[model samples]
Target: MSTLYVEQPWTSMSLLFRPHYRVEVFDEHDTPLMVVRESSGPGLQRPLRHTGFSGWTSFDLDVVAPHGQPIMHIAKQFGRRPHVRVSTPAGQLIGTIKTHGAWKQSLHDPSGQQLCFFTDIGRIDTGARAKRHGKRVRRDRVQINPQVTEPLRSLATACAVAFDVVRGTGTRHTSSGGVDWPV
Candidate 1:
């Protein structure tokens, strides 16, 4: 079983920039795999349309090779639940990432079958009792289907990273900023 790890470098200075992330992916053995970064230039109009002035601003992310060639493209859709679609440079759909809640997200195939699930490790209960006990925590666990092939597996990994970026699950301040509940 091949496992991938995603980490966002935290620089206190990042707070001054226009919301961008520099994410690094590593293998189980701790070797660097690929680098995923927010597109540095001007934001594209089409993708930005879906991301309103709300706390969540949708944008395009690129999975870059060591030599700086973008290998994959991840774009966030404009709507409730905010589906993030992963594709190749040629625009072929690889898979999509969707969140069920602040702590739970899943990756799906084009047909919408779940291929992987990512859960933020923490006390999901937010009741008075749980809050009084100070049980909040932060970490991530990814569970991927064993039957998925290599390329799709890679895309699923990228989906996990994209999920964190769009949702801002890494920082405590913005953890629940994008949540929208039904009436």
Candidate 2:
């Protein structure tokens, strides 16, 4: 399958259940698909900003799919979660970005990185588009269901670790002091 790298219009602050974030989706050929943007800010911004905080810790991602599928495809067949390791000077441990719980929801970090779960063929934009003609206005676009998995927590965690190692790197960060702080 061909690889597709869609841009997430939303910011990290919006995905943390803290405030509004926006996202836009495109197909494998750079075709516009969907968009999701928030109309308001998360209430914690002012307070956090005042305290010299930017909300969440730092998490970097390097998606390793060839062209059309996520890297976790094979490992996912065995269990619920899949570990994804990123290659960097400072290696990172990325947990499985899978669907969890009974409802099989999409799981991802604030940056819109595909974690344990993966998306199927469909429009994945969460934004609404509007067209105006004279005094009339029309809304276009639809909500695309993201592919997610519902797996055991333990299995998911293990998959995350394995994913990292599979990529020829073995480093995991468990302490949550934030990346900007001094070591």
Best by TM-score: 1
Q: What's the count of clashing pairs in each model shown?
A: 0, 26
> lDDT tens string, model 2, 47-92?
4322213223122322232342322221222122333222222333
| lDDT of model 1, residue 162 | 58
Q: Rate the local accuracy (lDDT) of all candidates.
A: 0.53, 0.29
Candidate 1: tens digits of C-alpha lDDT, residues 1-44:
44555555332232223355456655657676677776653254
lDDT for residue 135 in candidate 1, whole number 0-100: 28
Task: Show model 1 residue runs off by greater than 4 Å.
Answer: 15-18, 40-55, 78-80, 113-147, 150-152, 166-183
TM-score of each: 0.62, 0.25
